[model samples]
Target: MINLKMILRIMGILSLIEAVLLLLCAGVSLIYGESIINDFLMVAAGSVIFGGLLLLMGKGASKQLNRRNGYLIVTLSWLLFSAIGMFPFLISGYVPRVVDAFFETMSGFTTTGATVIDNIESLPHGLLFWRSLTQWAGGLGIIFFTIAMLPLFGMGSMHLFSAEATGTSHERLHPRISITAKWIWYVYFGLTLALTLFLLLGGMNLFDSICHSFSTISTGGFSTKKASIAYYSSPYIEYVISIFMILSGINFTLFFYLAKGKPQKALLNEELKWFLKSIIVFTAIFTVTLTYTSPYGVGESFRKALFQVASLHTTTGLVSADYMVWTPFLWALLGVIMFLGASSGCTSGAIKSIRLLILGKMTKNEFKRMVHPNAVLPVKINKIAISPSTQSSVLLFILLYMIIFVASWLAMMAMGVGNVEAFGTVVSSMGSVGPGLGLCGPVHSWNCLPDGGKWLLSFLMLIGRLELFTVLLLFTPQFWKKR
Candidate 1:
């Protein structure tokens, strides 16, 4: 039922492209006089050789990718890419442990901002740039890259796109998926470029600005400095980053509509409304709490509250302040925000607010049904009644998400992680929210996590980014059944 040859062929091509990108990283190393150039080159060469063999062997194969094959390909592609992605770190001896390297690569590809490297400033600029680039690539999605550039896949593109695309809904801005992919990336690239320029103007070096821009637009939140945004202490820079993070979390499809003079459509979208409302409500609460209870001035409290709420809600994980030291109430508030994530169909990760909104409405309708059994009520989004199938799918997805989250949390606890740390890491990893509350908190890294915990969290990150069904379906017997 799955096209193995076609999957391998696409993987080969993707690997080859990744290898080429690594070579560019090697150039950066050389230009910056970094010592890891040879190591990077060696890894790049191996990628090319391995990919070349697959390409040659799978040459002339049919390009069509069915649904089953698409999921298999995406899952395997991420795994394979992570494997090869670890080579540079391995060869450079920067990361001696294979597990740590794999975890880092997984984080990059998943666009999860968690890191094992504690001394980020100690790493070379080239490696840092490559790290940021991986997130940028992963942010829009590797499948999207393939879809936009590799036209031969045609109908197969939808299969891969469905597996990789975020959100409970998918939209095609153009009739052709390839064209749609290009438009998404065009917006993605434009935002990244604009953010880079703004950061540079705000007094960041070209290298730091570019890296930060990549991370910001991707909503990946990897900082070159050890202190993150705190290192700069520049209000202007923080404001700019907050704006882009919020923008990056929004559905790019809406931007396209706005570009086409369909601003009303974006405004009328239920998800957008919920997104804005959530930010406003949370910001207000956080501001009130911080201003009244904390030592900071009202203005300072508002700034901190708004920044943290935006960061966590968008799942960007950029820390402008040490949130752990904040009041317990504020800490708990942020923890909840981690699960809220940003808009679907964007780079942000979590159980999207739209699904939650639908579930809420569905729950309310069910309650009403108890009083009037003969009456009919429909769950509506954007003023349209959702079909039964879509509603069922959303409900199933939420259940699966909860199961995965609980299981992950329990696993972490079993691994000897403290309750606070376990809950934070599991939820944050599953939500693709980088920082947690305790050991993996905003001020901390997962470098000290046990190997088992690192691997488990890595898997969770992958599943979360793909959304539950795409990854969980891989485990079902029916998924493997021949059609």
Candidate 2:
């Protein structure tokens, strides 16, 4: 059964945190000139009032929520958070249209980095801060953040955590979900602080450094400048972001192991090895291509190739240069890399590299089984046997992900968008990768997209952010009916 009261209570808590975040953004506005202070404050107050009322009504709600209720709450909370989060954009009149506002907010919160706002640099300081804050909170996840930080959620959080976390495994670094969340956040925070300091040394202003770190560590690509990382024109800054983006793409759990003084755990980790090797292999291919095909010097070509490969591999959509003008083959190569994102349990979206590795192993296992029937062959990762159910679920997820991507791509193309742009947008939004190619390229924005296309891609962003099953299950007949 769906625990409506529990859902409300949790949603209330989430909304209050969101309200507090908005207020923080409002404070940033106040620190600057006072132009958009009212806009942020009014929305923040609304969030507080709405959240407060929910809290009052939800007093005495049962805390024993089941898995089904958790899924429902997780999906609804993401929708509600995005809905409420978009208000600053709407109230401030910066994003006047509802569809546009929702898309921008959804992208930010999903860490999708797909933006409809073209004049990003012209936005007020408060709104820009709000934009980055959404990504920061979303980096680890909003519900995970609330459950881990706020003691209010308590032990009932596991269901919600399972519903939101990537992959099938719920392996815990600590016995309690809250403690696990704390350690995860500690790693996330440390990385952010370190990245910000490095960016400062790389010559970014305090504000830009902070905001870019938020987006970068989250694998989110929202930039204050229109040209993204190219605005500073600093190779130092580009390389720094590249390094952090790769780090952010690794499983946060690995960081926890390292902190706990378990070096071998990270070293022997299958996912980390795959992620690292793919980065090196992809970057090498790209470097060779750029070196031979592009007019840049050998060193410049290698630098560009390495940075872009890191960006694409991690699904961090920041652009140092316009790669769309690169050889068509390399353009296609990057698009394919977009499909295989970095490690699971990180902020990156798309079919994660871990899943890709699982898929490959499963395929090999199948071929091996063809040679010997009734053999007890199990897929193993790091010497641990993977459950059959996990392998099956991973396969199904990839299938469903492709299906949705294709359907959305068809819809966008039907709306008269260019074929390449439509395909890129579908993959980009579905994977939460920021910039698409051709029309929606890094140099361009999604402002020119038709309203219908915006709505479709926004739904894609939500589904992708929830890891597909959580959102898709809501549409199933079994989910809505009582057992």
Candidate 3:
């Protein structure tokens, strides 16, 4: 049975966390001397009151949480965060429409980076900080952040961690899950800080540096300027951001292992090998194609190709140039990279490198099986044999992912979106990558999309960010039955 009281208590605690985030934004507003401070303060005050009341209602809640409660809590926490997170935009009158505000906030929290706001630069500093902050918090995950920093969920932390963690497996760096969470977060924060310093060295102002750093490390592509990374027009900035994007795409567990003085573990990781090799191969192909086909020289082509390949491969979505004008083949190539995202257990979304690695090995074994019927070949990663259940789960996940992509594509087309735009938008949204093809391309905001289309894409972002099963399982009939 679902533990309603425990759920409420956790929700209340999460709401308080949201209030703290809002107040931090309000502090920014005050420093900037923006009148929007009132809006943030008001919404934050409301959050505190609401959270306190929920805490009161959950006063005698049980400490234990089952699997169902964990799933429900994780899903509902995201929904609740988005619901409350939208108010700042609404109250500021910056995003006037309810749907627009909700979509923007949802995009931020999901780190999908799709935006309806056309003039991002015109927003006050506070809103921009809040906008970027949401992605940073979300990139590592909100509950996971709580698990790392707070000891509130004493008994059922494992349930919460398992419910939200992506990829086929959840590996712990430390014996204690909370300690593992802390180590991973430490790596995440370290990357963010290092990237910010690099951006500053590239001549970006402090605010833009911090914001872009947050977005980059989160694999979120929200830019302070409408032109995105293109606005700077600096190869230095592009290269730095690209390098950090690739770094952020690495699994935090690998970073944890390195931090714990076990560099060999990360070096020998099969998924890491696949991911880096794929980036090198994709970047080389794109660079060669652009060099011969476009006006770019070899150096320019390499720079652009490396940045774009790294961005989309990590699902970061920060664009340095308009790839829409490039050869049509490049467009399709990027879509594939976006589909095969960077390493698992990091900020990136989409079908992860580990799953792709497993699938590739599985395919190879199939041919071997056909040639030698009696031979037993086990799929392995890091020299450890993968269980049959894991291999099957990976296959099923990819199948369902494609099925949903096709279904959503058709639905978007039926909503009056063009075929190419519909395809790009669906893939981009579902992959948590920003920028799409045709109308939804890099140069454009999603402001042109119909409200219904925005809502549909918003739903796609949520499920995609949560990894299909977490949110979808909530809709399953068996999820709610008492065990």
lDDT of each: 0.86, 0.88, 0.91
How would you encode candidate 2's per-residue C-alpha lDDT over 209-297 as one tens digit per residue? 99999999998888888899988888899889999999999998988778779999998899889989998988888888888888988
* Top candidate when judged by TM-score against the true structure: 3
lDDT (tens digit, per residue) of candidate 1 on 1-483: 877667778888888988987898899999999889988889889999989888887777786777788888878888888899888888888888999999988888888888999899999977898888888888888888887777854335888888887455788888889899999988999999999999999999998998888888888878897778889998888888988888988888999998999999997888888998898899899889988888988887878887788888888888889988888888888888888888888898988888888988999999999999998899998988988988998888888888888888889889999988998988888887788887678778898789999999999999998887778788999998886
Residue-level lDDT of model 3, residues 1-483, one tens digit each, is 998877888888989999999999999899899999999999999999998888888888887767788889889989999999999999889999989999999899988898999889899999999999999989989989866644655555878898889567898877888898988888898999999999999899999999999999999999988889999999999999999999998998898688679999999999999999999999999999999999999999999999999999898989999999999999999888879888889999989899999999999999999999999999999989999999999999999999999999999999999998998899999999999889889989999888999999999999999889989998998997887
Model 2 root-mean-square deviation: 1.3
All candidates' TM-scores? 0.97, 0.98, 0.98
* Shift in Å, residue 150, candidate 3: 5.2
Positional deviation of 267 in candidate 2, in angstroms?
1.5
| N/CA/C clash count, model 2 | 0
- For model 1, what is the C-alpha lDDT against the true structure? 0.86
Q: Model 1 off-target regions past 4 Å? A: 152-155
Of the pair 2 and 3, which is ahead by TM-score? 3
**Per-residue lDDT value at 135 in model 1:** 86
